[model samples]
Target: MFVSRKSIWGHTGKVMALALTLALNGACGDDDDDEGGGDNKPGDSVKVTGKVTYDFVPAVYSTATRAGTLAFSQVTKKPVRGAVIQVRQGNTILSNATTDDQGNYEITYKVPSSGSLTIVALAKTTTPSIQVEDNTDGDAVWGVGTSLPSNAKTRDMHAGHGWTGGAYNAEQRFAAPFAILDSMYTAARAFMNVRPVQFPELKVNWSPNNVPGAGEKDDGNIGTSHFSPSDNEIYILGKDGVDTDEFDSHVIVHEWGHYFESNLSRSDSPGGPHGAGDVLDPRLSFGEGYGNALAAIILPESMYVDTVWSQRTGALAAFGFDAETAPSPSDDPEPGVFSESSVMRILYDLYDSGSNESAYDNVSFGLGTFYDVLTGPQKATDALTTLGSFVNGLKAQSGVNTSAVHALLAHYRVGAVTSDFGDGDTSLRAIYTPVASVPYNTNVTLTGGVEANKRQQNQYFVFTGTGRTMNISVSNLSEDVDVEVYRRGTVVAAGYLSGTSPESVTFSSQANTQYVLVVTGYKEADGVYGASVSITSP
Candidate 1:
């Protein structure tokens, strides 16, 4: 049996061992480890065996897929290969084994004087050992299990233990999935209080060999983690001598938020790189800000930390920020509607219990309120969804405290929010254009771009329907633009094209219904455009 002499599971300078014994009804099928059979014999141990499997949660990620159909979550399972299993007695190691491609493992070792032996599986690699498929490929093991897919194995290990938190280690690598599971459970609990929902199994991909430029250009970037909607997979960073994200609970939960958003609700976010203080695109701001805030809400901790390590040393330890600072200072030179910092602060302040006396701590609606709006109208709003759209959905809910909600928003410099479209809102730095009104048969000309207002770049037009046919057309556009018609918060018809082209749409309308015409540039495309709306009222 090989002994473990290094610390793992994020604990620094500590030791851990697994115990196993054949005394419990010949605990292990094979009695080779405990040959003496209850007779006091030196160098006698026990054996253990089991199988490992990882959970996979399939949810939609592409905006097109999500918009075309209502996606539901479901769980799938896959066997985990090459995870390490070990047996120990008290503080001493006895035996170890490596799982096969089928995830089966059998280990035999010698106990160090014990009445009962316990066995555990270590998800890391220790050199000068056996039971591995490839020693040079970095195909080290990770914690695996046969438990319910929704539950994480790390939580099971920490059960009944008072863990005061630890540093980065191999054992901690197994804990990351559990940490994300904890966040999902918190969100599920909050939402189920009003309406029930199930979280599909999520496949977490990580390894000690994962590093910068190891895979595809966007695929393998060290210290970067993302949830790919196309494949319904979560890829985390694992750097051998540098940064690894397995122990970064906040980061793990943040990526989980994207999964939740894409599946449970609707996210029009143009996914891209963003930071806390950057003035991002409105859609990107709301999605990223929601993720950051949700991570803190799930942990309910005073601070959110992300650590980076290198060469057996912590390059950046516990580098994080306060979660309670309202109207938080940001790195962006100018803060406005597109500021994720402002959005996150506003959201946290709204959900906080108001136990403190700060002006930003007066509102206390909780996560239930937040979840309700996101799953309800906000998910179906007839506007380019943003923070304002979410706030409007909140106000539309019954039993919501309007005073507290508005007060929380106002505290963050988001002026009086009276509609879902967020029209006519003017910031201190720029004049935001009001939504154009396209009466039954009126033609309107408008100009919009990412550089026009810096924040409110997407141009919106509103019209009242009359249970007939409505035809909308856009022409004279200088750049690639798409026009979508939204009714009661869902896209009814869209004029999406591959290149620069005129856009047009025709759809049956309900009487007295309010329809929003969303004319937005594709990515960096932006320019002036003319639109005409004609209605054939019966």
Candidate 2:
């Protein structure tokens, strides 16, 4: 029961000597002494046990009203699962362990008689390889620690929210990083259930100074919580008086969904600012919609809540919506294939079991079905990944209720669910206009309200090559234009000259092979433009 450290050490000395004698007498191989035996035997160390937990503030949201607040009063302790634990005496690590699902860890280390020890729990895991770091602090890993010797052998470290009395203490926000890690773990595990995947190391950057404005990431002016495909990093907002996303599980998972798409599936979205009411490009609509739906599915909750707190007023405000329900036409405005709201509702309906208010949602294909298509056909489709491409892939699956899917699609006003490129919709132009004749020329219109990636900002064209050299050009006297040629989702050629008109590109083509041309304005120019394509014999 309560054994003295001195007595234990004495007993361990006897056992070590006996083991060393046995090894010297040919009882074990020479490698046995080097392999955690002899002087570094298990009997020479003391077993350390502990649990790592962090305080969690759950969001209080209403499914009916689609709004909620951070329930600070209902704060609870959640296990810091799959996180690294280290026992250190000063700067030297004596032992290391990983917390189990229940936050329990066991480590063996030779306890020194004089020096004090500390237990540090890091917000990191090696299996899936994820780490949360403080951007303001030289990108140091976030962690919490407790004096191990002071707490005796059964030491437990609990990261507090740092909320004291009516205000938050900056030094006490130790729970934020762990909370973010838990949300990522939930999302990653959900996807792993459907498909076995080896995730790359993901670094999540967070800081108390991180606010809503574009600036240097190291200084913490991160603009907003977003996943950067270029750097493959996630920046989270943690401005104390403005906004903090530590408790916004949906928001965290939503950003993680983007990471999932980039690594596991495919995303052709022209990254930009988009919202529910905006008329976005079909690619952006589908990408954003899938993110929202994936978060809801991973959370296994229809309501998506983002809570914000004001320190001065001590008030909490939140705004969200039920991903399971379709928004009103007035709220969504353009509810169709180009609307993110429509895409989110359609995707959620496809995966969810049933909804009491949704009359048209009579199908539940489950997460496995959704994952299969997202990772398989949708990733390889020649056309941009849009609602049309996703639905077309779903319909191809055996035993899928196509009629029920059609009803959901019709409810969203997305027209027909036939082809990857919107085929049967007359209201929308053909996704790729065809250049049937050589020396083909046409006038195209680009009209939008200064938004760079809206539906009306760009136009697409297709052509069949005849084993000859081809010249493509776009002319706009008053506006800067750009052109790009693609074959099977890969760019063959592009013209992106700045402050210039009549941009052109040339390339040799193979016979009977189809190529797509995308023409757009520089900085979203709004005017009529002329485009021409001609073929010459090699």
Best by TM-score, which number? 2
TM-scores of the candidates are 0.59, 0.84
Q: Give the TM-score of candidate 2.
A: 0.84
Q: After superposition, how far is residue 145 of candidate 1 from its true place, in Å?
A: 8.1
Q: Please identify model 1 stretches exceeding 4 Å from their true place.
A: 1-196, 209-223, 241-243, 308-319, 326-336, 396-399, 423-457, 464-478, 484-500, 503-513, 522-538
How far out, in Å, is residue 302 in model 1?
4.3
Per-residue lDDT of candidate 1, residues 283-306 (tens digit): 778887787788778766634556
Cα deviation of 109, candidate 1, in Å? 21
Candidate 1 all-Cα RMSD: 13.8
Note the Cα lDDT for every prediction shown.
0.53, 0.75
Give the lDDT of residue 172 in candidate 2: 55
Cα RMSD for predicted model 2: 10.8
RMSD per prediction, one decimal? 13.8, 10.8
Worst 10 residues of 1 by lDDT: 147-156
